[model samples]
Target: MIRILLVLILLLTPYHPNSITGSKDKLENQISTILSRIPSNTKTGILIYNPLTQDTIYSHNIFSPMIPASVTKVFTTATALSLMGKDYRFSTILFTDDSNIKDGTINGNLFLKGFGNATFSSEDLLHFIFKLKNLGIKEITGNIVGDDSYFDNIYYREDWIPDESANVKLPPISALVLDRNKTVSKRKRGRRTIYITENFKNPPLNIAQKFKQLIEENDISVNGVAKSGITPDNVLEIAESSVAITDLIAMINKHSDNFIAECLFKSIGAFYSGKQSNSFYSQQAIQEFIKKNNIYSINTEIVDGSGISRFDQVTVASVNGVLETMYFDLKNFESFYNSLSYAGVDGTLRNRLTDLPNGFSFRGKTGTLNSVIALTGYLMSDDKDELIITIMFEFSKGSWNFYRDIQDEIIKSLAELKKESSDF
Candidate 1:
């Protein structure tokens, strides 16, 4: 009798995917109503997916081609994580052309050759200088040369606006990046542009100059003027970058560092092709990678790693696919996911979603341009399900605050979503 009762109960519990579907539809409708209040002239693209069930819960204008702004870093970082392992570390080597030395002086020029390490900083330079001092070569007979020959001479994208150079986020793209290719000036009126500078025309030359200063400060004599040059095959490596690739990816995504994104993009091309890095090669590699992942979309376009260019276009569905693929990737998920900005916690999202209710966490990237706004990342809904959400907007006349509010509302609604219960 007990066995019979158990069998009956098991047989009576029917599959209720349709009920869940109905709930999802209702939730989507409610969110759509909120989205409609933003602006009539705005072109929007949105997609929400359940990575666990591998289903798109809600989609609107998912196929529309929209400018993603900095959200394009999602594709850049994801492709990088897939191609380069999370533990990968980019090396910026300090080499000496000649090995012979006497009286603590080098007989040849010092070469600083970078293989696409964007996180290279003043501290790294100082540490390298210390290492040079430890090498018992206090004096250098030749100039300090910065070699970024791993990439092309085109440091700035053709499509980027000339005025955009004033913004630090769009720093010069180079293989050897030091302090993000920007110089810090004394503050005035409590105002200073993060990316603005008096001179950054040549990134390698700028880095070389800074390196020369650090060397001189460290009491290591650099007799020669710093300039951009190439290191010979026969050279002695002095120092390299200590930061891991995951950390660099975090910097790129969390802060939306355009310089790092472009460098990484070019590095991807250089890595795969073993040739000089260029945007065309990077886009080809990204396109091939996108295709290999089966993320097919009619309108997907990528010209630069960072979405600072107005020419970049990507479909909502394609970006969703990219996010879903990265989230589910077993080996690289932690590094990739942790790199995103966590809403109300830190990164670009440090101040957003502060007024949300309990059981909500929006971890993602935020993108903003004069006419574009985008937010894409993960939303942990009530600790029961995880949703991948991407919200993009291209507006003619609307305040960015309004768009951000709408995006936050959408995320809030999704976080509060629940499955319907059946009453038979």
Candidate 2:
């Protein structure tokens, strides 16, 4: 009876010596065929590596540097997660000189000092006011100062074009960002007409004035103007930001927010350099990180964290290295993986790969600049392999949709790879 049971088990199990290798070769062939269909004028870089098997399934121009666009955020956010833990939270403190007050009246300036909390919002101001009310502080006798001294004076990248600077998405990045350093106000010109626009000329002033309004609404009196100033030597902590660093990463990658990326980049610089952070210092910190991880590829250059700069470049192999590192680190794996835009689901990928029925989950970041498109992240194959894939294109002439379709087709072919069953 035991012999009979063992024979039945052997008959049911389907194992082959060459199945894994054959499937890998087949997947590589499909991907190569798809890449061959690309226009001759266009150049592409592709890499698909399986971390579990320690296998390089396919590589095309993998070592050549290409424009990464916003896909560069994967490296930025990954380094941030490595340096700053998943639980790290930025704090925006309300400091006042008067520690002892009589009946909710402070006789000194109320300073709002920021530590690069990019997600800080106007509602947080109200919460601070509430905290002040609870602390028996009803009036501030001095200016409601906005202290953004945590960073340098540079607002935007020097290479950023005028048209790109004109965008609301690319606002003046400062340490103390309120409502993402921009505001939109509704105006009524006529009975049935409405107009809305952004107000982002001065981030500190915008935050100061809004904070004053919220304080007044909270029944607290402010008898002084709101302006930019440094925090005094001795002050009491009133309130701090409640958002976590992990969520800030999500805001940067999932939305491809150029503003937040710059702000967070400066924060990383400050954390590493132990000095007032600027974009240059941020770039230096990123360079140091790449060196520490041995991730630099040929001609790889970076000018900004968001990849909005046309100067930023990365090789497919380099991007895949970062992806693989994040995947292997168990402590940060969940946070880093979840921060990417999910295909057919949310973030920058909400409108892409919607009709594909691949039995896998695609979490990646999409990047698009004029004539350049990049997609990089992890693709869970139907065979339960975590595939690190990066597809980049620098076309002489082509629509973004054109390149995006090719990227999707290559991934579809990858997801469709399977091994033939062996008959007993």
Q: Which candidate is the best by lDDT?
A: 1
Task: Summarize candidate 2's per-residue lDDT along 166-258 as a digit string, tens digits.
Answer: 223477778888887878776777675565667467777778888988888878899999998889787878778757878989988888988
Prediction 2 TM-score vs. true: 0.88
Residue pairs in clash, model 1: 168-195
Runs in model 2 lying further than 4 Å from the true structure:
1-25, 159-169, 354-358, 418-424
lDDT (CA) for every model shown?
Answer: 0.81, 0.79
Q: State the displacement of the C-alpha of residue 111, model 2, in Å, after optimal TM-score superposition.
A: 0.7
Q: What TM-score would each prediction reach against the true structure?
A: 0.86, 0.88
lDDT of 1: 0.81
Window of ten residues with lowest summed lDDT in model 2: 415-424
